[model samples]
Target: MAAPAELQAALDLLRGLRERHGIDVVTTAQAARSAPAQAAALALRHLLPADLIWHIEGHEVLARLASGDVLVLGLDPSPRVNGRAVREGRLRRATIDEGSARAVFELAAALWSNPKFLPEIEPIGTLMPPPSDALAVPRGMEFVSAMARSDRPLPKVVDEVPTPGWLAPGLLGLAGPRRQAFERTVWNALRFLLLHELGHVCLGHLELGARKQRYRMIEELRIRDGAAPPKAGGLTDEARRALEIEADGFAAARLFGEAHERDASTGLQAGMLSATASALLGAALVPIIFHAMQVFSETPEPLSTHPPLWFRADAMMRAAMPGAGTGALLDAPLRHWAANDALQRPLAAAGHTHPLLGQWLGPVIDGGLDGPARRVLAEARFARDGLLRGRLRVQQQVVPSRGP
Candidate 1:
């Protein structure tokens, strides 16, 4: 069956934008055959809000991009990792690089498939702090770091490293239930990435920026007209940080809503637990993805737009599982510890550890500590309230004025 005319036009607009951005947009027929595209199709079908439909020029277009509406470009060799959402007028489109998506899936497979990381008989316990010599570097850190940070093609990088048994043969080699489970993990991770971008669009971050810009122009005019100098009336650095955090919260809430709805409808305890676990895992990977792409720093920078990766991870957890105490919040930190330890084992056996791992592992591992966890929860609360107010102020300014 053919797509409606409006939906086809929306897809065409997305294709043009992908090409303009040099993303090597593929034909709709070709995209249908791509794995990443298929994953995206499943996400759009199951994850997107059913009630939401977009209208362009009085004709309805699908709210989210249908499977092949945008290009699924191959591995991005550039430093920029993860998917991006672009807006052209009322239309918003998102695209994910196959390379980054593959990297995330491979990481998940490396950890999940390995018995050492996730034992079948028992759950991994809380982790202790790294030893004093931890700074000396673990064994396989070098190879992992190179694979993560190198601009070289991902396949080439993987080939250069000694293939570990865990990740060997890559994601494709798995079969039966294991493959199904692996695909779910990848889709969960992709869902988080896709929704995070969608959060920016839905939350009106771009619109907020425009409002701030217009406010500044109006304020400047007032200042030049011999009126008292206008106070700061634009988005500040802190405000930008807040917007990023808000988007993370938005994504987390959407994930939680989906899980909750599924659980409610099915009324199956096992299915509910599995869905919840997958949602948490997806949220936890958001920070790891940033770190792997080399976009995240171990410590927060003074002028950085986004919060530290750890903080964002914490914020998402708090938002998704509201009212949960410190004990509940420990899920993410524990998962990080297990994943880090698992990945390290193979690398250490190979006599090298990733350099990037050492940088963030200390703080992330420490996140399991009661002191740090409490501090993060408190800080996240304060930040969330402040940002919400800032966003409200922007909305007020941009709202159309009512006639007197």
Candidate 2:
């Protein structure tokens, strides 16, 4: 379909900006071949209203793209792992870097290739109800065990693995059902990234951001004229953080909220995992991607625009599975992070074990929650109940549920 007038206008503006800045933007035809682009198309079909058209284009820049009333999302062709939604006048642009998609596949490959992390990565078969005969396949742990016992060398860490294009086969030497499972996990993670950006558009965040920009511009002009700036007025830091959380909630609900028992069987047959499994896997991988990208430190950044990665991951799990307790949802990611961190560090280094492994895994071994994990759960619960519940309810009333 041809782009809508407003969306095309926004694309033209983006085109001019890129040209003026000497940045090369990918052609639409080229972008359509990308995994992130394909994921955006599938997601938009379900998440967008029929009348609300959108377009995808790739860029060379590594920065997150912005969105507004117009819906022309951008994707970065580079391999850098990052995704975000920003504000552009009348344009709702959600940019996902190709690196982010590659990171998802790499993380899955790393976990699946390792014997220790197999159980954590492949909880679908064991944790969930068993699949029917037709959907049955070797569990990840089974495959890893076979590989370990065989002459084939186990898959290496991210640095050693020969990275393939997004969603390409032979990722870390995985194939067949195992490969499909990895691909599904990566695809769902991309969907979550896109959906988060769409959430900003759906929740009218572009409008709110535009209002703030206008206020800032007015205040700047007042200051330029030597007039005393009035009391500060615009989106506050707290509100910005709240919006990030709300967007996370929106994306989680849309991706995993409507999942049903049938999805396990049906999704497997269709080369997808159950929504619950997808949610858990995506949650585990997203933080890993963020850490790899150096987007933020493990510790909280008080002045940062987004919440801490752990906090965002916890918030997403809560939104996806509100009824479930804080046990595996948070523990799974912490475990995966610990394992990944261990593999990344020098083996001979003293005190090399991931701190989280000691803190989180020790408690899991003892059959209880740890102190820091408990504190994070408390904060996530408080935010969900106190800040997000009412806002989400109102947003749902205005935004249409995704299509079947």
- Each prediction's Cα lDDT score? 0.45, 0.43
Shift of residue 276 alpha carbon in model 2, Å: 1.5
Q: What range of 10 consecutive residues in model 1 has the weakest lDDT sum? A: 215-224
- Residue 275 in candidate 2, Cα distance off native in Å: 3.2
Per model, state how many residue pairs clash: 10, 8
Candidate 2 overall lDDT versus native: 0.43
TM-score of each: 0.58, 0.55
Over the stretch 301-349, how does candidate 2's per-residue lDDT look in tens digits?
3323445555655444444443332332322333222222212221111
TM-score of 1: 0.58
Q: Candidate 1 lDDT (Cα, whole model)?
A: 0.45
